[model samples]
Target: MSIQTGDKIPAVTLKVMGEKGPQDITSEEIFAGKKVVLFAVPGAFTPGCTMTHLPGYIVNADKIKAKGVDTIACISVNDAFVMDAWGKSQNAEELLMLADGNGTFTEALDLVMDGSGFGLGNRSRRYAMIVEDGTVSHLALEPTGAVDVSAAEKILALL
Candidate 1:
């Protein structure tokens, strides 16, 4: 089953392009003691993702924080390098871009979507979840092929 509210995030290492170098960070490191806003997109730089999904989070990050969020993260199936570049391109310094390159975490959460038809291999569905102290508190997942439900503005409204 897909991870749901009250479920602890699966323990897995996610690659992040850190200032020093590539960092392998665990879900525990990210959500163990923090109230985190985590959102996933199908891929980096896709039309809907770039134009609305990620930018909504970037634009409303401070408001999300005011609701007691400790961190806001954007996740995708792309690698650290691409995620880093996308973050830079979007001017999203305040958000964390996590690279779930291998899809271990995505599969564990049952969120992986096959994109081979698009020649993109496997990717995460567009979705967002709120985690507190390692457990999910809320989830807003897009219906397959739908974009309106998982937008950052909707998530911010939840908070």
Candidate 2:
């Protein structure tokens, strides 16, 4: 089943680009004691994600953090290298770029989106969630191919 507002974040490992290159981070470490806003896109650097979805977060990141959020992160099914490059390209220094390269974390959350038709294989559906110390308090899942409810503006509004 898909993750719900009351669900705890699943146990899985994700990647992030560090100075030493890709590094592994556990889900527990990310949410265990933090108020986090995590948004997931289908892929990194895709048209919608690049031009629209991520930019909304980039612009509103401080405003969201001011509302008591500890971290704002973006995740995609792409590799850490791609996510890192995209973050650099967008000047997303304020956000954490998480890479669910193998889609393991996405699958653990039951939020997998089939992208075989697009030659993208398994990917994550567009969604955003407010996680507090390991438990999700709010979840906004976007419709297929849409970027409405999961946009940063909406997440900011919720905050």
The candidate that wins on TM-score is: 2
Q: Per-residue lDDT of 1-159 in model 1, one digit per residue for the tens?
A: 999988999999999998886789999999999999999999999988999888889999999999999999999999999999999999999999999999989999999899999999999988999999999999888887877767778888988
lDDT of 2 by residue, 1-159 (tens): 899999999999999998899999999988999999999999988999999999999999999999999999999999999999999999999999999999999999999999999999999999999999999999999999999999999999998
| TM-scores of all candidate predictions against the true structure | 0.97, 0.98
Output the worst ten-in-a-row residue range by lDDT, candidate 1: 143-152
- Model 2 residue 74 distance off true place after TM-score fit, in angstroms: 0.3
Clashing pairs in 2: none
Q: Candidate 2: where is the Cα deviation over 4 Å? A: none
Q: Model 2 reaches what TM-score against the true structure?
A: 0.98
Q: Report backbone clashes per prediction.
A: 0, 0
User: Best candidate, lDDT-wise?
Assistant: 2
